[model samples]
Target: MIRLATVIDTFEADFLAQYRDQLTPDHYRALAAMKHCRTQASPMMQVKCTACEHQKLVPHSCGHRHCPHCQHHESQQWLERQLKKQVPAEYFLLTFTLPAEFRTLAWAHQNVVYDLLMSCSWETVRTFSQNDKPLQGTPGATAVLHTNTRRLDYHPHVHLVMPAAVVDGKQKQWRTKPRGKAKGGYLFNHKALAKVFRAKILAAIETAGLTLPARYPQEWVVDCKSVGSGESALIYLGRYLYRGVIQENDIVACANGQVSFRYRNAKTTRRERRTVSGAQFLWLVLQHVLPKGFRRARNFGFLHPNCKHVIALLHVLLKCVPGQTLAWVKQRAPILCTCCGAVMAIVRTRIPSPFTGQLPISIAAEGNP
Candidate 1:
């Protein structure tokens, strides 16, 4: 189970020792947390089996959103929740990308820029959905902020999971039918999407006192592709919610103060490996660590948590059983005994002594000593 954390745990102290002055508190904190994550530095709990009387110690995860190791459970929970909100209609994956001129500043002003990106994307979807020519109903969308390009470059963009169908504003009834009997199921005008999206993004930039080059293209990149059935796509996109720009599985090698990892070539559609210094690799991952308490995924229109009643009404409109959604998201307990087939219960729990970085000798001596 060698992972990115293994490299981090081994090399991060040296990286920090050399580059501490150049890093931020968040970067230092993230690296420290990841280094100690699920290791001796973290707290542990003692769970005992009722039948076999066997005891086990489980370490606590740092549970930081950017920690790739800890966020798998969060991703699953999000996927199931989004699936339950699915309607019997078409779905669209809309990506609103910043212009080339904006990437550098967008990284520097991440919170402001990303918030504006999400807002503009939501507004674009809302406005287009409300156009009388299309339908007067509002569509629900969830926006995911992505800060890395395929090459792991610092390119900030937003990925939106939006439905092709819109619902009546007041009635909350479906305003769209199955897109087409065949393959031509177009949702919105891509040209117009590009136009509106660019306009909103530029306006937001100016409003926030941010500047873009005057010679920049009038149209920013807006990708709108209809995912055949959104259930799988929505679930697939859920991976980005809690993960870093890349995953542990993507790492190919880590040695000699360098790290190599694979990425799918966006243009050639082929796999490629990239190698960089350990410090640079740490920088690549840390830059995407969001501001504390900043949300990476957001629900807009009816999918919002504030409008749960609206979601309930929509569920009724779509004929979804209340009980079924729970079945879709049943969380499994973690403490299972292996020696005898029985459930384990937490007999005692406490943080290990910070000074010694170890649990009490009485408990530590029992299991693996």
Candidate 2:
């Protein structure tokens, strides 16, 4: 498998030369973190074995959210938290996509546009739920912003994984969408959803003081499809939530100034390979680096962190077991002693990197043998 760090190290100079003027601080930061992740240039941790007292210094992960080399623990924790709030109802995955004509505008003002996209999508859904005859109440949703397509193109979209349920705060009631006889079980009219979503987002952009493109698509795209139980949908979204856009294992080869990676084509449902100049590939990946401190995933309505009691009550009333539906997240494997085979525990962390011109203080000097 080709590592992202290897690709970054090889193509960084060319990438910088080609796009230096276009690079943002977030892009530079992501490049640096992914390049040194788990390498000798990164910080180190000292661990000692329980049985044999064998001590070792391990390189620490950079822990950047965009670094594909790390954050497995964080990703799993997020999935677990979402799973804990799962309710026994049919769920739907709703996707709202920005028109191609708006790409340049979104790229120039990402934080504003992205936030508006998410907020507008949620607001559209909330509006629809309140107006629906059966569910005249606010609905809960978990929205995640994705900035790349399967081929790593700069396509910004927001996906909302929402249960078919709504909570009436005033009436103190919970109601689920009546399952329709349609083929996949209906949630809402996709066409109507697209219409409302388009208006809301366009108005939102103008309200935010951004110039609207003179020629934009009259019809935007919004897809709503049923995903049973919602656990699988949450897991799918969680996979790329912390890890970078492209997985390292998907990168098949890098040779002859070109990098090749594979992605499953969404429409064709088949695996396909795309090869591009190393510099171009780097640009494709780095262009997706979100603004510093911007949240890519969020919970709204009842799935929010502040609604634990509400979720807990629903779980009891509906007889839903949160973690029981999905397989338990396995604990991280413990470091083992080569001498005695016992587990090793971290004794110290944040040791200076060798590249920093400071020697890591010996663990033995800290009074441990």
Candidate 3:
């Protein structure tokens, strides 16, 4: 089977061959890291119930959240973590996107564009939540940056998870609010927020001395929707981050000196086959190389400042209040061992580095005969 890592490897080389001399030191390192290694691994089991036997092995997965090959375990773990932080009230997933006309500019000014997206979105959400009459205080939120569409194009966007209830600093109360179809729940005003988001981004870019298409200064695209609940929100946004850019079904062929993949037009369902010369393919792969210490996921607002402890404190405080319940509990699902039908105990858990022959070491629970 043709692996996504191989394709990415080819692309990394192509990138260096073409732009090695042009990239800065940091960019060079990022490109090299992307080109060489980016896979993570977890233990998996194949169980044969009838035979009362099981096979345990360390499965290597493309650790790239953007790669489809490694999403299941990664996303599941992330969801489990999010579930523990769930509040009793409604949750909303808000997405902020940039216009396609800026794709080339984004590619050219990755650092500038990416920084603006994060800052602008964060400020926009924070300001809007506080200004909304229903949510009079700063509505706590967590936002993440997403730069690629389903087809791996340069579709930069931001995803935010916001609470329906905002803490009322003045009265020390929890103020609940909703907008549009999400009445009585955590909702965002898309049209209004979009307008403000556009304004904020343009202003920020201009203040930073960056120029945009002259005719499109007033036109920036932003999309917002209220995806409900923390679980649903995780599942929805997780899909975009994990298994996002590359698809297993989209693999056309891998042979000779080239590997081909398919992508669909964002505006149309029609499929298109795009083949990169082996060198060119490697260059594309290098584009995804993230700088070391660059976190793909982060928690902000109420969830920030060491999320678990902060949320635990909030949960306790909420229980003491009039409307909140103390029965809220966080539960984790059990992982069963396929081998011998025994409950598998995790002896160790490791996230492997992308370099080859690297594996995560974990031991299973065993019972005495």
Q: Sort by TM-score, best first.
A: 2, 1, 3
- Cα deviation of 289 in candidate 2 (Å)? 0.4
Off by over 4 Å in 1: 17-22, 181-184, 321-333, 353-369
- Taking the tens digit of each residue's C-alpha lDDT, what string does model 3 give over 83-105? 55666567777788888777677
Query: How far is 130's C-alpha from truth in model 2 (Å)?
Result: 0.6
lDDT, residue 68, model 3: 53
lDDT string, candidate 2, 1-369, tens digits: 999989988888888788878987677777877888888888899999988888999999989898888888898888888888888789999999999999999999999999999999999999999999889998999999999999999999999999989999999999998899887789889999999999998899999999999899788789999999888789889999999898999999999999999999999999999999999999998899999999999999998899999999998888877878658565567888888899999999999876842211222233321
> In model 1, what are the clashing residue pairs, if there are any?
none
lDDT of residue 187 for candidate 2: 87
- Across 1-369, the per-residue lDDT of candidate 1 in tens digits comes to 357678886567666666656565566567766766777678787889988899988877777788877877788788777876776667889988888888777767878999999999999989988884656778888888888886777788888887777768677467764576557477777789889888988888898998776668876678887886576567657776786778888888888989898888978999999998887787788877888778888998878777788777877767865345444454645678989879999877765835334332222334421
Q: Where is model 1 poorest over a 10-residue stretch in terms of lDDT? A: 360-369
- Give the distance in Å from residue 189's predicted Cα in candidate 1 to where it truly belongs: 1.9
- Poorly placed runs, candidate 3 (over 4 Å): 8-77, 178-186, 239-244, 247-252, 256-258, 262-280, 306-310, 317-369
Clashes of each: 0, 0, 5
lDDT ranking of the models? 2, 1, 3
Better of 2 and 3 by lDDT: 2
Q: Give the TM-score of candidate 3.
A: 0.67
Give each model's whole-structure lDDT: 0.76, 0.89, 0.60
